[model samples]
Each structure stands twice: as C-alpha cells, then as structure tokens.
Target: MSRITLENIHKTFGKVKALDGVSIDVKDKEFFVLFGPAGAGKTTILNCIAGIAMPEEGVVKFDGEIINLVETAKRNVAMVFENYALYPQMTVYDNMASPLRSDLYRQNEDVIKERVYAAAKMMKMENLLERLPSQLSNGQKQRVAMGRALVRTPNVFLMDEPLAHLDAKLRNAMRTELKEMQANFGTTSIYVTHDFMEAMSLGDRIAIVNQGKIVQIGTPDDIYYLACNEFVAQLMGDPEINILSGLLRKNGDNYSFLSNGSEFVLPADAALMNKLAAYDGKSVDIGIRPQHVMYSFSKDAGYRDYQVYSYESIGNKSVIEAYPAGHSGRGDTHTHVRMIAPNGLTIKIDQLIYIDFKLDHTMFFDGSSKEFIGCYNEAGIRALSAGKEEA
Candidate 1:
C-alpha cells in the first residue's frame, strides 16, 4: 500500500473546470471516499489518479514520490468503474486472469489461477467463474469487474461507484463485503460515490466535493454533525434537512429563534449561546433534520399548525412534508419542512397537524453566506473534528 497525494490539482476541459485547486492526503492503507452529486467532478478525480486524465496543474504522488508522468501500467493502480468494464467474450475467470497474463504484470498460470479463485470467492462468485460476461446479470458483471481488480496487488484501489448498478438489497450486502475486504487487505483505496450511506459507512475519512472543489474533509461523524455549510448538511441526510429562515433574538437572558410565525427558544447550552451572541438581531438559517421535528395529530399546546403537503413511504418509515396553514404548497415560502413518521400513519393532503422544532438538535447558519455558524452541541462536534485531525 502507498500514501497517495494530489496537491493543488487543476483540470479543465475546454470551458468546463473539472478540478479546481483540489488537494488531498490519502494516508497509506486508508479507505478515503470522494462524495458529491453527479457532474461534480468525482470521476475526474479518479481518472486523474489512474493516469487516464492528467491534471493541467499540480502533482500526483505515490509514497511521497512524483508519479504524474508515469505511464498507466507503471502506476499499478486497479480501477473498478461504474459501467462494469468487463470483456463481453471472456469468462469471469479469464477476465480476472487477464491482468496477471499481461506483459506489464505477468504471473505464472498457477499463481494466476490461485489469485483469480480467491478474488471470485471473496466476491461470492466462485461458482460463476466459468460463465461469460454476456451470460451474467448486471450485478454479476459488476462483481466480476471488482473481482478482476481485486486479483491485482496494486499500490492503490480506485473504485468509481462499483456497486451503482446492483439492486438495493445486493448493494447493501456488497457494501458490507467491501468494507470487510478493505480491512482485511489493508490497501490504500480511494472510492467515489454519491450515496451518503456508502460514504459514511465505508470511508475512514470522506471529502465532500462540490463544483470541482473540496468543501470539507473529515470522518462521517464530523461531516454529519458539523457540516461546514448548508449544501453539505443537506447532502448528508435523508428526506433532506429543513433550512428554516429565521431571526436570532435576545429574550431576557436567553436566545430564541423566530421562524414561520412562531418562536422557538434556543437551547441554553453555554457554548452555543455564546457563539450565537454575535448574530443577535440578525437573520439565520436553522437546520433541523427530519427526525428532530416532532408532530402531533391533534391540536397541541406548543406545536404550531401546518397543512400536510405530501406523505411518502421510504422503506419502513415515511416522511411527512408540511407547509404553513395559509400558503399554497406550490412555490411559496421556504417554511415547508419534512418530518419522519411511522409507515402506517393515515395521512391525507392538506390534513391539519401540529409540529414543533427541536431547538436542541438545530444547527445555525449565517443568513447571507449560508455557512454553518454553530449548533447546540458545538463543543462535542468540535472535539470530534479535532480528534479526527489528530488521528
């Protein structure tokens, strides 16, 4: 395994800038993930590492040595792409053995057979080794692609959404297998995926990329709890985080958030209160995750009235999307918020309900910049970020 570094990398294609001043230090034997929406340059970073696409500026290094000018074969990097780049006419075993048969990294037949079977077993495709790529399902073909890469002892493993084509159940299973494989192999790996769950579960450290730039880099806990900005907070959660437009006000030795015709008393944590003092009497965006917003079917004392906009089932749980009482659900204000509810709840459009914000779980962001200011558990989150850096 090798420590990989890309410093001040800049890559452009005509008018589009794919990577802009991107720098990252992937520790030796670490599983680092690049996470972002599509068209956000995740794949470009992989291509740059593989030597398939050279950066216009900056250097790519392996174990502290420059490898930017090195040929692809010399780089010794195994890449598993999203498209399952397998040979149509070759059997699974042949496809995996092809890498070892190549002149650049050739091995004897016995060695090739042993490595191929081992990889196939790890991928749970040992029985399918003799089947041609054309005779396999999309998921099976993707596994073959990964198996082929696993047969090589490369300096680093670059996987670009390797399980993107698998069904949800299979994807979940493969995710577990991949995590175990990484731990057992102890190989330096860079994985790119837009799935937040995969990023959180598989990566030792995750770098959030957006518009060809690094937004934040930290462990899953750091990113989920201490998001650098609104964009990142929304990306890391399901049902999306509610960005409530509100004002910060001092109410006699306490801070309160005013939003959507209601006032929520901010938690009296000393750390959060002290940091919020600077934004007094100013607008701020309060981030409330769906799970933190509570709902009551009937009228309640502290809960405010809302009309149901939509209710959709997600697996075993459901999300209730609601808007203010009078506003049209169609392109109105930003008061619309989502809350997680039980799957069997009987709900209807425009049904009246009461909801309350859990101020203790809210995150504050600057109104203008839309960047994170602080949250209720500011000190704990800061400690987590600091600990990750130290590690």
Candidate 2:
C-alpha cells in the first residue's frame, strides 16, 4: 500500500493553466477518483504523481517522502492510459509479462506466468493471451493494457479513463471489476474520468475538479446531498438540479422566496436567516434536485403553480419541465423548473399544473458567488451548505 500526496501542484501548458494549487492526500489502499470534464487536468495530476510531468510548483510525495526529482521509471507507479500504450510487436503474453521481466521486478519464469495469468483473469482476457495488439479489438486492447498494469505490484496505480471507449454494458461491468480488483490488491490507486457514475460507483472518495481547481472533495453522497457550489451540484446530477433565481421575502416573522407568481416557503431555520440576512430581498438561486419534486393534479398542500413546457418519459422515470404559471410577462422568460418522478403518469407538454418544491429538501445559494447558502431539512426547518454550511 502507498499513501500518495500532491501539495499545491501547479502546471501550465503555454498560456493555459492545467492545474493550479491542487492538493490531495490519497490514503493507503484507497481508491481515489479524480473526476472532471475534458481538459480539467485529471490526466495532468496523474502524470505529476508518476513523474511523467513535473509540476512547476509544490511537491509530490509517496509514503511521506518527496519524489519531485524522481524519474518516471523509478516512481513504481503503474499507469493504464485511455489509449492502450502497448507494444505492437509483442504478443499479449509478452506484453503482460514485460514488467515481470524488467529489472525492476526480475521474477522467475514460473512466477511471471502466475502473475500474468492472475491479471488476465481479472481483466477477462485469459483467452487473448497470445494475440498481438493489432489483432485485437479496441476493447480487447484496453483489457490488455489494464492486465499489464494489474500484473505489476507497484506502489500506486494511475488509471486515466481506462474504460472510456467501451460499450455501456462493458463499461458497467468493468466498474464492478475495477472496484473488486482494487480491494483485492489493496494498492493505492487514483482513477480519473469524466463519468459521474464511474466516480460514484468505484471511488472510496472523489475529488471534483474544474478549470484548474478542486471544487469539492468527499464521498458520493456528500457531493450529491450537500454540494459546495452550483457547479458541483450541476455536474453530479443527470437531468441536473433546478436552480431558480429569486429574492427572499419577509412575511411578518416568517420568510419565503417569491418568483413571478410562485412562492417557495423558506424552512424555519435560524442559520438560514443568518446566511441570508445580507441578501434578504435580493436575488438568490434556489436549487432542488429533480427527484425531490412532487406533482399535483390540482393545487394541493404546498403546491405551487407552473406551466409545463415539456414532459418526457424515459424508461423508469418521467421528467416535467416548466416555469411559474403566471410569469409570462414578468421578464423572467428563460426561467425553467423541472421535476423528475416515477414514470407511467398521464402528463403532457404545454399543460398548466401545480408542483411541490419539497422545500426542506431544496438547496439555496448566493446569486453572486454561486455558493450554497443552505438546504432545508426533511423536517422543513434546518439548513446546511453544499456540505451543510461549512460550520
């Protein structure tokens, strides 16, 4: 097992900053995920740790010792790239056994065969052992690359979108195997990908990176239930969270948000009041995951009016999108409200309906900073930041 650390790493390509002060402490035997969109620096971080690319600033450490000056060959990190970097001339057996034959790990022929066979089994490539790289399909080549990495008993495993181009079914299956392989090997590993499902399913912990910065770091639920900012919330969800811009209103001793003709009652929360004190009556972005939304045949308890612009049924779930019913001429023309519910409901586009916000399950954010202000508890009264208010 290895404990890998990247301290305030900074890297630049020409005028573009690839990574900026990104720091992460990957625990021993932990499966850490670096998740972000393309060009967000996921691969760069992996390279920095492997000594493939040196950071302009900060230090890279392995098990408490600085490895900033170490050579890539001496780092003892095994990397499986999206593009299979296998030797075309070598057969799969030779490719998988190459590491064992190297000076770093001069294992006997019998031991090399044993390790290669074990890795081939893990990657489901036992039958493709003798195929050359050119004779195999892309997916088969990917397994070969993964098998090569797995056969090595390296200090850390760096995987950069290793399953990205596989078919959906194969990708899902690999996720399970990857998790199991990491557990059995207990090798400190960092896997990078743009897929939220991969990160949620395989990571022991995840770091959400964006535009050269780490936005938030936590478990899948911590990021889903409590987002640090609008970007993180938007990135983690499929249909995305509903973010409405409005102002907080003072109703005697109570408070609520009024957007067009729709009103979202604020949960009774002192912490929320404190957070919103400065911005009371000013615009704030209200975010609610689509799943937390509930529909009404007519105006029911806590139901607000809306105008459905579109309704879609996708297998097990249906999505309803709308804006406030009476806000047509109020200048908020682009405001959209969406709700996700179990499918098999009779609904139509252009229909006027009432929907409940489930306010306690909703999230509030500062309009200017786009930072989470609070979310109402299920009891309809407490609040927390994207991480429950940073307190």
Alpha-carbon TM-score of each model against the true structure: 0.96, 0.89
| Model 1 residue pairs with clashes | none
* Deviation in Å, model 2, residue 376 alpha carbon: 3.1
Model 1 poorest ten-residue lDDT run? 177-186
Task: Pick the lDDT winner.
Answer: 1
lDDT of 1 by residue, 1-391 (tens): 8999999999999999999999999999998999999999999999999999999999999999999999888999999999998888888899999999999999999999999988888888999999989999887888899889989999999999988878889898888877777666668999999999899999889999999999999888889998999999999989899999989999877898888778988768888888889999999999989999999988888899999999999999999999988889889747798999999888999989899888899888999999989888777877876786576
Q: Model 2 over residues 1-391: C-alpha lDDT tens digits? A: 7999989999999999999999999998888999999999999999999998889999999999999999999989999998999999999999999988999778999999999999998877889998899999887888899889888889999999999988888887877877677667678989999998899888878999999899898877677766889888888887888887788877655678987566766777776666767777878888888887888878888787787777888567888877777666245644777788767877776678888777767778888899987765522332322343232
In Å, residue 330's CA in model 1 sits off its true spot by: 1.6
Which pairs clash inside model 2?
Answer: 226-386, 227-386, 385-388, 385-389
User: Residue 288 error for model 1, in Å?
Assistant: 0.7
How large an RMSD does model 1 have?
A: 1.7
Query: TM-score of predicted model 2?
Result: 0.89
